[model samples]
Target: MDFELPEEYAAITDTVRRIVEAEIKPVIGAYETSGEFPYPVIRKMGDAGLFGATFPESLGGTDAGFFAITAISEEFSRLTPEFGYAMNQQAMTCPFTIFNWGSDAQIERFVPDLIAGRAIGMFALTEPGGGSDAAGAMKTTARRHGDIYRLNGSKQWITFANACDTGLLFAKTDPAAGHAGITAFVVEPKRGRGYRAHPIAMSGLSNCLRSCAVFLEDFEVPVENRLGAEGEGFKIAMNALEYGRLTVAARLTGLAQACLEHSVTYSKERLIRGKPLGEYQMIQQLIADMAVNIPAARALTWRAAWTMETGRPSSRAAAQAKYFAGNAARHAAQAMADIYAGYALADEYPVKKIAAYVNMLTVGEGTPNVQRILLAEDALGIKDTDRHPVRNRARGHLSR
Candidate 1:
C-alpha cells in the first residue's frame, strides 16, 4: 500500500502543525500545571475545523479522510499529547459514533454543534461494576415507559463527563438478551433533560480531566433519542471503538516522536565525560531504536486508517497497531527518562510529561495484553475463554 500522503493531506497536516506550534504548545504546560482542561484552546481547534476532519462537508467538516485525521493527531500530539486527547475525544470517539448511529434528527441537532465546536461530546460505556465484560456486567438498565426510556445505571471513567454537552450512553434494555440486550442513547445534561454528571478526581491522569463516574437515576430520554434501534448499541460501540483504536495508535506515535526528538536533542547538546552523549554507542543505540520504532508505528497506524477508508475490517489491524504503538511509546518515554536522568522527573523537562502521556496511552484505547489476546483470536481463530471477548480493556468498559 502507498504510504506517501497526498498533497492535499499534507496541506491539512501542515495546517495542523502550524496551529499546534502557534497555539497549543506554548500553553500546554500551564494548563497541565493548573489542572485545567484547555477549553479555550479546544474552541480554537473547533474554529480551525479540526473536530470534523473525517465527516462530510454537509456536516460542517472539511470532507477529509481518516489519513488527514491521523496526521493532525500525530502532529498535535508531538507538540502536546493532552491536546491530542481532546482532539480524539472530539474527532473520533464522540462525533464519529453520533454520525453513524444517531437518528437523522439527532445528527441534525448535534453534528453541527460538534463540528462548530460550540459544544463538546463524550462517549459513556464503561461502568463501575463492569470492566471488559460490559455485556455481562452491565447493570445500567433502560426501562421502557410510556413514551420515554428511564435510564438507571452509573457509567464510570467517562472522559470529559463534566465538560461534555452530549454523550453516547449505553444501557441494558433486555436483561435476558445478554449482549443483544444493550441499547445506546444520546444523553444530554441540560436544564430540561433528565441527566446528571459528577466529576471524579484522579491523580494519575492530571493532564486532562479524568473520566467521571456518572450516575443516571431515573434519567429520562425521549424515545427519539435512541441511537439506531434497541439491541444495536453493542455493534455501534464496537464499530466506533474499532476506529477509535486507530486514533489511539496515531496519538501514541506522536508521543513517541516527541520523546525521541527530546532525547536526541538532549544527547547531542549535553556533554558527558568530555564527549557529547550522542557520541556514546549506548545512547546512539537508544536513539536508533527510537527512530526505528516511531516510523514503524506510524506505518501501522496509517495502514489501520487505510483499512477503515477502504471498507475493510480493521479490528485486528487496529488491535495490533494500538498494542505495538503503545509499547513503542512507553519504551521511548523510559529511554528518554533514563537519558535525561533527574531532569526526567521534573515537569519542566517535557520527558516527564511524555512519560505520563505514554502511561495513559498504553492503557487508554486498549491495553497491551488485551491487544495480544485479540491478535491471538484473529490469527489462531481460537475463541477466548470468555465468548464475549473484547479487544482493549481500556475501552472495553472495565479492567479485564
Candidate 2:
C-alpha cells in the first residue's frame, strides 16, 4: 500500500516530464499535421536511457525497472498522448517479445539495435476482420517450407507498421490447432519483398504511432526467425499482452492525468459570471471526479506491474488496470471537454485532441468490453491463474 516511488524513479519521471514539455508538447502538433514520425524525439529518449529504462544492463540497458518506464510514460502522456504511447511501444514493441521467446541468434541480432534506436520494431496482431476476436478471426498463415516459412496475411491497425524495420508477427500454422495453431515470427518488412504497407486513415495517434495495414504476401521467413515453437505462438503472444495491457493502462492513466490538470487550470482562470469556474459546484464536481479517478487507475496499473515484476500471474490484474484506466480516460476527456465548452474544440487546447487518444486507449491492446468480461470471470472465480504462462517464462529469461 506504500504509495511512494523510490527516489531514483521519482527523479527519472521528473526528467521525462520536462522532456515532454520542452520537446513533445511544443512540436507534436506540427508532426501531427505533417503526418510525419518523430524520429528526433525517439532518439532523444534513447539518448536519455529511456529505451533501455527497464531492460537488463547486459542487453545495453540501464536496469531502470518496469515501474520507472511506466512512470515516464505517464508523465509524457499528459502533454501528448501519442508521444507517451509511441515512447512505450518504441522501447517495447518487438524487442520485448524477442527477449522473451526468440532464439539466441534472433535476440543477438535485434535487441541491441532496437534498444539503441539504431533499428525500429513493432507488434502485429490485429487484422481487418476483427481485433477483439484476435485469435478467432486471425486469417494470417505461415506455411512451412524446407528452410523458410512462407507467410501470407493482412494485418490492419498495426502500430508503427510503416515505421519499424522488424516486428513480432503471428500467423496460424494449423487451422485445426485453433489458438494453439498460431506461431510467432520476427519478420523483416521491406516493400515488394513480400512485405507492403498502406497507411490507415486513423482518426487519432496519426503522428504518434503511424499505424498501417501490413501485407505479408508469401513473405519468406527463415525457420530460425520463429519466436517460439510451432504452436507456442498463442502462449508467447498472450504473455507479451499481459504486460502490454499494463503498459496501455499506464498510458491511459497519463491521459486521465492530463485531463484533470487541464481542467483544473481552466477552472482557475476561466471566469464565469463574477467568479472563477472553480467556484461553481458543478464544475467542482467534474474536477473532483477526474481528480479521484487518476490515482485510482494509477494504483491499479502499478500493482499489476509490481505483481509481474515479482514473477506472479497478472492476467486478472492487468485486465482490472486496463478497464479502470480506459474508463477513467474516457470520462475525464469528456469532463474536460465539458469544462472547456467551445474551447475544447480548439487545437491549442487538449480536450479536442486527447479525446481521440482516449479512443486509441479503449480500443487498442484490448477493448474495454473485453476487459469487463475478464474482470467478471475473475470475480466469479472462473478464470484460471495459470492461464498466463508467459510471465514466468519471461522471468526465467530475464533472470538468465
Candidate 3:
C-alpha cells in the first residue's frame, strides 16, 4: 500500500527536472521558432542518463524500472511535451523492444547507442491505411532473399523517421496469414539502401519533433537484423505498446498539470471588472476541473506502471490510464483556452501550442474509441486481457 516513489526514483526525477530547467527551458523557444530538433538538449539528457532509466547498468542504463521512466516522462513533459516524446521514441518502444525480443548480438549492436541517445530510434508500425487496425490492414511486406530481406511499404505518421539512424520496422512475411504473417526487422536507414523519409508538417510539435511519411522501396535488411522468429512482429509490437501507453499517459498527466498551473497563474494576474479573474466563479470551476483531473490521470498512470514493473497483466490498466489521461489533457487544454480567451491563440503564449499537443495526444498510442472498444470487449468476457502469451512472457522477464 506504499504510495510514495522510492528515494532513488525521486532522485532521478530531480535530476531530469534540473536538466529541463537548465538545458531545455532556455533554448526551447528558439528551436520551436526555427522548427528544428534540439539535438544539444537531447544529448544533454542522454549524458544525464535520462534515456537509460529502464535498462541494466551493463547496457549503460541504471535499471531504474518502469515507474522511474514514467516519472521521468512526466517531468520532461510538464514543461515541454515535445521533449517528452523523445523518452518514448528513443527509450520505450524501439530500444526496449529490441532488448526484450532481440538476439544477444542484436542487443549488443543497438541497445547501447539507443539508450545513450548516441543514436536515434523510430518505431514503424502504423501504416497509411490505418493505425487502429495496423496488423490487419498492414500494407508493408518483407520478402526474404539470401542473406537479406527486401522490404517495400510506406509507413505513415512515423515519429522520428526523418532523423532515426535505426528503427524497428514491421512488415508481413506471409501476407495470407494475416496478423500472424507480420515480422519485425531492425532497419538501419543511415547505412541501408532504399529508405526514404518525407517529413509531414503538423500543427503541433512541428518545431521540435518531426513526424514523417516513410517509404521503404526495395530496402535491404540483413537476416541477422530480424527480431524473434517470422510472424512474431505483432506480438512484439503489442508488447512494446503495453509499455508505450504508460509513457503516453504520463505525458498527458504532465500536460494537464501544466495547463492547470498556467491557468492558475493567469487567473491571479488577469484583471477583469476591477478584480482578478480568480475572483470569478466560472474561472474557478475551469481550474478546479483541471486540478481534479490531473491527479486522477497521474494515479491511473502510476498504477499501470506499478503493474508493469511487478510483471503483472497490464493491458487493462494501461488502457484505462491512457483513456482517462487523454481525456483529462483534452479537457485541460480547453480550459486553458477558455481562461486565456484571445491570448490562447497567440504564439507568444503557450496555450496554443499546448492545445495542439493535446490534439495529437488524443490520437496517439491508442485513440479514445480504440481504448473503449478494448475495455468493452474485456468487460463482456469476450477477451481475457490478462491471459495473453505476451503478458505471461513479460511476467517472467520483468519479475526478474
Candidate 4:
C-alpha cells in the first residue's frame, strides 16, 4: 500500500497549521487561563472550511474525505487539542451523523450551519451512571405524546452541551427493549424549553473547551426530529463513536508528535555537566522511543481513516488506532515530563498543558480498557467488530 498522503492532503494540513499559528496560538493561552470558549478562532476555522472536510460540496463541505479530516485533526491538535476536539463535535460526529440518518429536511436545517461553524453541535450519549455501558445503563427516558416526545433524563460529559445551538440526544423510548429500546432525537437547547446544562469544571482543556451535565426535564422534541426508527439509537451512537474514535486517535497522534518535538528540542539545547542533554544515553533512549512510537500511532490512525474512506469495515481498525495512539501519547508526555524535569510543570512551558491534554485523550472517546475488551472479543471471535450495518451506510454516504 502507498503510504504517502496526496498533495492535496498536505496542502490541507498546511492550511490548518497556518490557521493555528495565526489565529489560535495567540489567544489560546488567555482563553485557557480564563476558561472561555474561543468563538473568534472557531469562526476563523469555520471560514477556512476546517469543519467541512468530510462533507459533500452541496452541504458547505469540500468532500475532502476521511484522510483530510484525519490530517486536519492532527494539525489542529499539534498546537492545542481543544480545536481538534471542536472539529470532531462540529464536523465529524454531530453533523455527519445527522447527514447520514436525518431526513433531507433535517440535513438542510442543521448540517450547513454546523459545517460553516456558524452553529455548534454535540452528541449526548454518555450518562452519569455509566459511559461504557451507556445503552444498557441509560436511565433517561422519552415518552411519546402526539407529535412530540417528552424527554426526561440526564447526559453527562457532553462536550459543548452548554454552548451548542443544536445536538443529537439519545434516550430510551422502550426501557424494556434494552439497547434496542434507545432512540435518537435532534435537540434544540436554545430554541426549545426545559433543557438545562451545567458546565463540569475540568483541569485539562477546560478553559476553551468544556463538557457539561445535560438535564432534559420535560424537554420536547418534535416527531420530525427523531433520527432513524425506534430502537435505532444504539446503532447511531456506536456508529458516530467509530468516527469519533478516529479523530481522537488523530489528535493523540498529534499530541505525541508535539511531545517528541518539544523533548528533542529541549534535549539538544539544555546542557548538563557542560554537555547537551541529547548526548546523555537516557535522554537518547527516551527520544528514540518517541521517534518510533509517533509514526506508528500516525500510521495506525491513517489506516483506520483509509478503511473508512474505502467503504470497508473499520471498527476494529478504529479501536486499535485509538488504543495505540492513546498509549503513545501518554508515553510521550511522560517522557517529556522526565526530560524537562521540574520545568515541565511550569506555566510558561506548554509541556504541562500538553501532558494534561493527554489525560483527556485516554478517556474521552473510549477508555483504553474498553478498547482492550473490544480487541480481545474480536480475537476470540466472540464478535466481529468490523462488520456492521452502520459501517455499510457510512461507506455509501461518504462515497456519495
Best model number under lDDT: 4
The parts of candidate 2 lying over 4 Å away from their true place are 1-3, 21-30, 390-394, 397-400
**Model 4 per-residue lDDT tens digits across residues 1-400:** 4366789999998899899889987888798888777777777898898998877888888888899989999888987677887977788889988988887899999999998888888999999988988887799999999999999989998998988887999999999999999999988889889999888877645566888999989999999999989899998888888888999999999999999999989998999999999999999999999999988999999999998888777899999999999999999999999999999888788787898789887898789999999999999999888757544334574321
- The sequence of per-residue lDDT tens digits that candidate 1 reaches over residues 40-135 is 777788889887877778788876777888888888788766677776567877787777666678878887777667777788888887556667
Q: Which residue pairs in candidate 1 collide? A: 131-398
Kindly list the per-residue Cα lDDT of model 3 for residues 297-351, writing each as its tens digit. 9999999998888877888999999999999999999999999999998878889
TM-score of each: 0.90, 0.94, 0.95, 0.96
Cα-based RMSD of the predictions, in order? 4.9, 2.3, 2.2, 2.1
Please estimate how well model 3 matches the true structure, expressed as its whole-model Cα lDDT.
0.86
Q: What TM-score does structure 1 among the candidates reach?
A: 0.90
**Following a full C-alpha superposition, what root-mean-square deviation does model 2 have from the true structure?**
2.3
Ten residues in sequence with the least summed lDDT for candidate 4: 391-400
lDDT, candidates in the order shown: 0.78, 0.79, 0.86, 0.87
Q: Give the RMSD in angstroms, all C-alphas superposed, for model 4.
A: 2.1
Candidate 3 lDDT for residue 354: 82
Best to worst by TM-score, what's the order? Answer: 4, 3, 2, 1
Error of 4 at 135 (Å): 1.1
Query: Given candidate 2, what's the lDDT at residue 206?
Result: 56
Worst 10 residues of 2 by lDDT: 391-400
